[model samples]
Target chain A: MDLWVTEYQTPSLGFSCKISETLRVEQTKYQHLAVVNTDQFGKMLLLDGMIQTTEVDEFVYHEMITMVAINSHPNPKNVLIIGGGDGGTLREVVHHPLVENGTLVEIDDRVIQASKDFFPQLSLSFNNPKANVIVDDGIKFVKQHKDKFDVVIIDSTEPVGPAIQLFSKEFYTDVYNCLKADGIIIAQSESPFFNKDVIKMAYSGINNVFNTTKLYLASIPTYPSGLWSFTIGSKKHDPEKVVFSGDLDLKYYTSAIHQAAFMLPNFVKNIIT
Target chain B: MDLWVTEYQTPSLGFSCKISETLRVEQTKYQHLAVVNTDQFGKMLLLDGMIQTTEVDEFVYHEMITMVAINSHPNPKNVLIIGGGDGGTLREVVHHPLVENGTLVEIDDRVIQASKDFFPQLSLSFNNPKANVIVDDGIKFVKQHKDKFDVVIIDSTEPVGPAIQLFSKEFYTDVYNCLKADGIIIAQSESPFFNKDVIKMAYSGINNVFNTTKLYLASIPTYPSGLWSFTIGSKKHDPEKVVFSGDLDLKYYTSAIHQAAFMLPNFVKNIIT
Candidate 1:
């Protein structure tokens, strides 16, 4: 018997992975979550039938999402991650010695529990002293904390269900208020190829709230399109200009890559601008 | 009735598209060819159960493959494209004002026929006065020509069947002899994620024959990984430096993108070096 887990990236397009076993599947309070062991991508996580991450390519998504925001800030001491229940973004945040505290607010406790059980490589950071894992709505958490964080990384899923509010202009305004004077917020904007509307929506919302807004790209194979975009809304610092010079042992993010990521292709520029 | 076409990118992974109709399917002399009209990606061409190009996303692959080499050369007048039967690369090549003549050598004539029948946007280049379309083995054609071309673009499918020799060192050595002193060669090296060994092989072979060899990346969604790699082997000019200042109204490639594409992430750099 052959078992394959397929994510309908669109109604017309699907990405399937052959799975050796379905490790876990449960309908949480928020969404449907599943953990499966795959032959090609190792262990995989799915939420609402969409691929959240795989053990093989999580480094690219995690490093690109967190390090770009973390390194762009001048002195990123306090960091807040919204919806990174898997703990991959938190792992990257805590890796920076300058990041004194990293707080993650995820609404789904079941995702955190599943990651803790099946994805130890990512969930290991949950035990770190610098990492504070919280189970609550991200919007509420950001609204309560004012001028506290140097960087806020929105590691939410697509703009659907629980994530619909996360992509709105009002949510960005709240995030902007939650940041310090020179705070930077980086959100995983969807693929420029597949989700132009979502990218435009996120960019427009973020641009309206922040002093400077820029869109960058990274290649995450498991995403809807392998090409994923991240929108950075900065208060003072320019993400194109690297403020932090220190280096970390990383798989994807480099000074060159940091600069290159901001160089948007002409077509992608058209979508956001 | 639901009609979907899925390309098993690996035994463990598959990418599928819902098709309104299978426009064309035939066992060519070289390989099996199918043109699918997809709801999401428009018309897509598949060869031997692999995606060759799509109407919506072909611009990214065609522009990146041709413009980088054409603009990098001091004067790219005579160009040769091996295995680009779809005429997309030829279209980009002929668009450049500097290119006096563009020759496309495709082993299979049926791909050209299908493209002409179903993909007029790409196949329109076949009628250009500057385009010289030839149906022949690219390897043999390269062996016969000497010091004739300014740029050679290898727009081949994966390293299998008829394209196996296209990735060989001996073939690249022949291509080197076929180019003028300052000529450049750009080949679509497979994805760094899915085809690491192919990338390593192509890079090693090209590096051995060229004075300056560099690997670049572009996001091509229909391909295995949404991220695709292109390898450039130049005899005298560095691909990083743009020599042609004249701009075509292009969607993907730009002067900044030319330099930015060469910026490989550390993990990809690790694969080549």
Candidate 2:
């Protein structure tokens, strides 16, 4: 018998990977979580039937979402990540030697526990001295904290249930308030090919709250449409013009890629503007 | 009952699309060809069970493959396309006012007939005065004509069956001799994620023949990895530095995109290097 795990990207589209074994499956407080070992992608993490990360292609998403914002900021000493309980985003954040503090706020502790159990490559960062792992609602946490972080990364899932508020303009306003004068916020905007409405909402929400807003793209094979987008909202810094001179060992994020990611295709650009 | 067309990208991975109807299916002299009207991607053309192009995202592949080579050369008048039986590449070639002659050499006549019967949006370019559609072996055609064309596009299917020779070094050397002194050649070099060996082979083959060779990327969701790569071999001009000033009504290719497409992520760059 053949075992395959399929993610229905749309009602008419699906992507599947052959699985070797089911590592773990549980109903978390927020969503359905599953960890599976696949023949092609190695260990995979899924939430609410959506792929969150895979061993083969996790670098593209983690590096792109975190490094672009971290490198763009001049002095990114303090960072806050929301909803990335898998610890991939936090792993990328702590790579920079200049970063003194990295805090991750996730609503569910079950995701963190699963990552610790199955995805040790990513969850190992939780033991770092600079890392601060918190179990709390990201929205409520942002409301209480004001002007503390140099970079705020909204690493939430799709804007369906728990993440609906994360894509709203009101939530962006709170995130903007929780950042320093020259802070930068980066969020995982959905695929431009599949989620035009979500992209437009995220871009517009960021645009309304920040002085400079930019949208960039990366190709994550496990994600919907294989093309994923990131939206950056900066209070003062321009991500495109920032000079990143760091020599962090990376597989996907580079200085050239940093600038190139912001150069959207005509159809993708039309989605936001 | 529901019907789905699945492309087994790898032995362990698959991408599927819901099909409304099977418009045509035939075993051509060279390969098996099929045209299906998909609910997500509109009409899709498949050769030997691999997607060649789809109506919804065809512009991304067609524009990226042809425009980069045409714009790189200072004066591209005569252009040759190999194995693009679907006529999408020809449509993009004819869009440029500078392309006085666009000759397409496809191995199978059945593909052209199928395109004309079903995908009229792409096959309509065959009627243009500048288009010279010929059903011939591209390898034979290139050997017969030396120093004839300004741009040569190898838009063949995956490196399999009849298209296998298209990725060989000897074939690239022959193509090198078929071009003018200031000529450029572009070929659809498979996915960086899935076809690393193929990318290396195509890149090294082109590099051996041309003074300058570069690999670039685009996202075609219907393709194997959603991230697709194209290899360019230039004699005298660098594609990255090309200033495309034409106002061709394109959906994907732009001057900014022309430069940005060449910016490969570190992992993809490591493949060819």
Candidate 3:
């Protein structure tokens, strides 16, 4: 294969970067991150050997997983974000001032360290007073806690590798037990654009326990197919009509965006429903 | 090279289509039409070799471009859409009964034919009596017509290949000349993340012609970066304070999103200012 590396310069970011035939590497202090130019997804963002997000875009995946279920429950005082080492979901959650406390349950401290070193903007959310960092396995930590969190955001990596247990039915049940009544649970199931079979299985598994199950989209440039979906499950609150009183002054999240986020495209609406 | 394809099955469509790579050839409709997989963009809807919107999601991009700008303009009377061959923008535009006559000028006849054949949902808009379709060069069309349109939306593709001319400084001046005193123009500039240089050039070029210029963003999965920016140029109205009055009962476009769309990310905000 021809190694075609072209450096793209952003006016805001002074230095020019590269887009190779195999990988578009952005050199940072932590590691050499790769963005692949795929035939399907225009570009896919990768770190080390793991998929961070794909070309099709995964902001929907990060946003919906963090926002929909968590926002569904009224007055979410204390919050927990598990395994979202990248801090994208944490960035979305910290926007809500009502979120008095937000604890991140991440096993690999390296992920957070790498993100902070490379992606500073996304990692900035961790500096908030509401954030409490706990570098531990999400499964082990949730089992010990008893109804302490009003909402739990499972921003896990994927079903493969160390994140295998995160996709299991047991994880959903444990997450259900960890939240208070009228609480919500949102998990970053794999990309619905590429991993629908796994996404459907996870959707059904979560649906069995919760009264409300819904899927929504966000476009992330580094995700597969530029289309990413997140499934939300709730015990008490209806996922559709939740009174969002608190405003985070988000660039993406809004009352209209909240409602529109649930309005799945006909393609996604068909598969899971 | 290792070829991978992924599929996002739509039960509603009753066809489990091959979306991105990770999956091989799913099915072929005709001699020229074959559904191929991709690694980056999940499943893509391709005809011959060109890309239509993927089966998974198209609404996000279409809605973001149309609603945000359309809603920002106070009373969209006479509208002109340049290079929107897919008819998605026209579909969204016809939704507003306030629009007197909606004109669409697309240079590529193939895109129009492909969209009409494959995307019936989007093609349905052209049937409206309010819409007038013309096959001509958009830049030249704007140059010929002076001061006729109220809202001009340049919904063209990337600034490569045939779209190079669309990004030129001369074309923007033509757009300015084509709009009425209070009329505004919104063009989908490149991404803030990857294509910031192009974005700055576009902004600077548009600024040279129009007095009021504002750069806004939307999350588009198909674009290079999940971060996509749209530059709006106006003659009389302030891009910051353009009051929108149209109520189309849209899912994505609302008063809140109208404001949020204008909020540039901190990284993007730093450079342009």
Candidate 3 deviant stretches above 4 angstroms:
A1-50, A53-81, A84-137, A147-153, A159-186, A189-219, A227-273, B1-56, B116-119, B125-127, B238-256
lDDT of 3 by residue, A21-121 (tens): 45345554444556555443344456544557533334545555666665667788888888777777787777676778888887776667656755655
Query: TM-score, each model?
Result: 0.99, 0.99, 0.62
* Candidate 1 lDDT over residue span B6-59, tens digit each: 999999999999999989999988899999899989999999999999999999
Name the weakest run of 10 consecutive residues (lDDT summed) in model 1 chain B: B242-251
- Show where candidate 1 strays beyond 4 Å: none
Query: Which lDDT tens digits does candidate 3 get at residues B1-273?
Result: 443221211111011222334322233322133334433433454433334455335666677677666666777788999988778889888877677888999876666765676567778888899999998989889999998998899987667666778888999989988998888888888777667777887888888999888887665544444457888888877765537664556544555555656755345665577
What tier of docking accuracy does candidate 2 attain? Answer: high
Query: For candidate 3 chain A, which ten residues in a row score worst on lDDT?
Result: A8-17
lDDT values for all models: 0.93, 0.92, 0.67
* Residue-by-residue lDDT tens digits, candidate 2, B201-247: 99999999999999999999888879999999999998788656867
Cα deviation at B183, candidate 1, in Å, is 0.9
RMSD of each: 0.8, 0.8, 9.6
Q: Give per-residue lDDT, candidate 1, residue B128.
A: 97
